[model samples]
Target: MRQFSENTFESLVADTQFIRWAKGEQVADSQKWEEWKKNHSDKTREFDEACKAVRMFSFATPAISDLEVDYLKQKAFDRSKKQRNTLGTVVWMRRLTRVAAVLFIPLLLFTTWTLLDKKQLETTYSSLVENRMDEEISVVAPIGTRTIVDLPDGSKVWLNAGSQLTYPPIFANNGRTVHLEGEAFFEVSKDETPFNVENFGPTIKVYGTEFNVNAYEEEEVVTVALVEGSVSLAKSGGELFLEPGEVSFFDKSSETIHVERKNLEHFLCWREGKFIFRDASLNSILRVLQRQYNVEFELSNPQLGSYPYNATFQNESLEQIFQLLELSAPIQFDYTKGYLNKDGAYVKGKVRIK
Candidate 1:
């Protein structure tokens, strides 16, 4: 019943309900905690800090049961309360050792697997994208999630939010090919086989290089920005080639491609968790914000959508972003953490801009 506040961190860390929630464990009081969180939006910073503190205790190289973690944490809380300044640090170290004894086993297995296969290949995403062969693998990055995919041929892909990538567990005799549904940055390993990225807009082929490809379902075109090396796109009119620092827009409807000289940094920034806009329109900025934060936006005046703005945002929360946007443009904003709909699906948060 205690809401998180300035002095609540110590108590929250002690609370099993809070600790469970932070570790992503489902507790009986989760519904109550969720409602509390919704009502106490002003304490988000403190709540986040507390949650992080709890999660930091997560075992890396072992597997400690959740109940065990709860017990150790409670003991830490008792010790901290008695010796606030000096003993708190020592208690932290002791608790870390006690828990690590159990958690290290799991961490060791995870590390071994990471070295062998990278992250595990997800089998649940084929239905979200398309039917696949038994040997095919798929990965989906939901809203606000970025997924890294290690392909069979040693090529690596970074899928943007709401994106899906499908490829064979091992490429067909190393004849590299992959299908993408949204956006991704590609770091192709040099090989004789042409790496093919098939999307709704175009088929991009490259021998070796780094580039970004965006083919979101809502967008009518596929955008390919080459960073290094060359890429060729198959279009209806003809084959179009792109060099470094060049962008190719392939329209799905027309099957035509447009080549333009543009800055690769603008296209590559998202992979680094940064949003960089150079003379970008308000509409473009809103689209990027919505994609990254899984939020909705509306322009109070349609004219505001065309207003050009320039800025870079990295690690800024949605509220912080709203403030920065308002200060930069002739815009004021209102926000709503929208409620669940009749079907029990929660609506995305929405921002209104004037």
Candidate 2:
């Protein structure tokens, strides 16, 4: 038997057991079922949550069958084939091909469809709550994960770790207002609502602008770096405007603000799938890495935290990323098993020079 990592366990369960069950295979007596629950508790919890969510819905119930399953498989295969052929082709041709392959699946064959019409309407509304959910024109990142959220207005947001941006699911009647926590970069679309991002320390108001924001809490100051157009920063009862190639730092503790001009590419590199560092300390770089890779480190040598380096890595593997780091700084790392305690699995990471 081989030791299974988190990625392996997740892939096995999703690919083998789940697919077989969906395809109507006899899986109740399989050893994989037990192993799946044992190795991946998160997947088990997610399954349970999904079941609970469906139980709350008053609308149709769907069941799987052999013929229907075969049809779906064929549909998926055909869709994939069409997509491959349509790639690098004209958009209208792909649209026509998709229209030719459409199939409809009914929700449920319950005899009480009319009896639960009102209840179904309510359930439908609840499902769409996220539809009306506010999406302010701000960059938002999750606490431990990078959020690649697409805005309701067709704009894309690359949110960093330990940050969150709150906006309506769709743009509202007036403007876009998003609240931020840690940091994120934005490539805004030209919309009607003046885009405004309110960070923990300062409020950044903009309209159809590109910028990078570094306003992580516990830092000495909040920084907003603009790459294009103009941004307005309001803090401590004062308003300051910034232009391209300029950066603003506001000190919340002291109620002071500092503005400077610098190369915009240095800050915009992360959005391009690269990490650019110029004389950045190990600790500073680690902070960004933790956000990007969702990994934590236990520095064995406290002094190693102060080591500074300048480098850039774009779309590099973990091995490549670490090798690049080692080229400039002497350090070693290991892939650790997730911590398994009474609460299940949690990540544990460490970094040191050997």
Candidate 3:
């Protein structure tokens, strides 16, 4: 035989089967219902009394209403006057109807208020090991853009508009290990074995390397371009190395790896808040702006895509940047305060390079 108290009733009501039964979608066997009712007779009566109290108390009005005062007096008299067979099945069915009639309006208002509110929940995990353990990790960034995180060891990372990077909470006892997804630029702290960045299946082992890694899930290839220092790239168990001006592309889907030489500065210029474009197309430049300033661009001119420019700015306002770009480019840019309607002060309309 199973037993249930007040605490268990809340959980029992939370179950899908109980909810269906409560809603009359399905009914439990008559024999089982009778057995459960008999075991919980006393608690069921107490639960009804508490529910009646909740239904009667009105926070909006500090003082009890005349009807509520009358109900309270009658309840007291009923308890004092005589023993009543109110815990029986027949009485329970009647009590349910009366309770719903008294509480329905307030209960509906409470449910509506709860449904409209936003709820945020967070979870954390921790581990303690007597000896030691080695592990690899990965993370999925949320739907929208987020800022890059600077590590404790003076290393800088610029996460792409939407991407996740996961590493040990503390660096390994023997090595510095981290993983990246989407895109990120790293100015790593020099270590003995260097700092290693692994994505997909390939690994970039470097000694103080300044590089940008684009491993976006939509893209078939993972590109790691070295701006400074040496980086070793190993793909599909094969190892290839790069010098300061080299770029390596690994096809994660097909495992085809290629290494090329390139101009490192044009690719790694975001570090100074500069949208450095050697000959970048308008579409490509807007993508960079969208990530850098957290803005949306509606490009109405198809001709704007092919125009190219090179520029850099630090500590400049978005309006100033947009003014400069408008003078140099043929396209016009407009501004609007997106999401201002939802969060009044969160993001204001300030134009950047158009």
What C-alpha lDDT does candidate 2 achieve relative to the native structure?
Answer: 0.71
What TM-score do all the candidates reach, one by one?
A: 0.58, 0.54, 0.48
Candidate 2: misplaced stretches above 4 Å? 1-145, 153-155, 170-174, 218-220, 252-255, 330-344
- Write candidate 1's Cα lDDT for 1-354 as tens digits: 545576766777778888888898878877876786788788767778898888888977687899999999999998877788667778898999989977998999988987666433344344333454455788999888898988867888999988999887655445688999999999999888878898987788885589999999877678999999988987554667888989998787887778899878888888879988888788878877777889899888999988998889998988898899888877898999868999999899989887
Candidate 2 residue-wise lDDT, 318-341, digit = tens: 567788787766687664534667
Provide backbone clash counts, one per model: 8, 14, 0
lDDT comparison, 1 vs 2, better candidate = 1
The candidate that achieves the highest lDDT relative to the unseen native structure: 1
Q: Model 1, stretches more than 4 Å misplaced? A: 1-135, 338-345
Give the better candidate number (1 or 3) by lDDT: 1
For candidate 1, the TM-score is: 0.58
Worst 10 residues of 2 by lDDT: 102-111
Q: Pick the candidate with the highest TM-score.
A: 1
Worst 10 residues of 3 by lDDT: 120-129
Which residue pairs clash within candidate 1? 61-103, 61-104, 61-105, 61-107, 62-103, 62-104, 62-105, 63-103
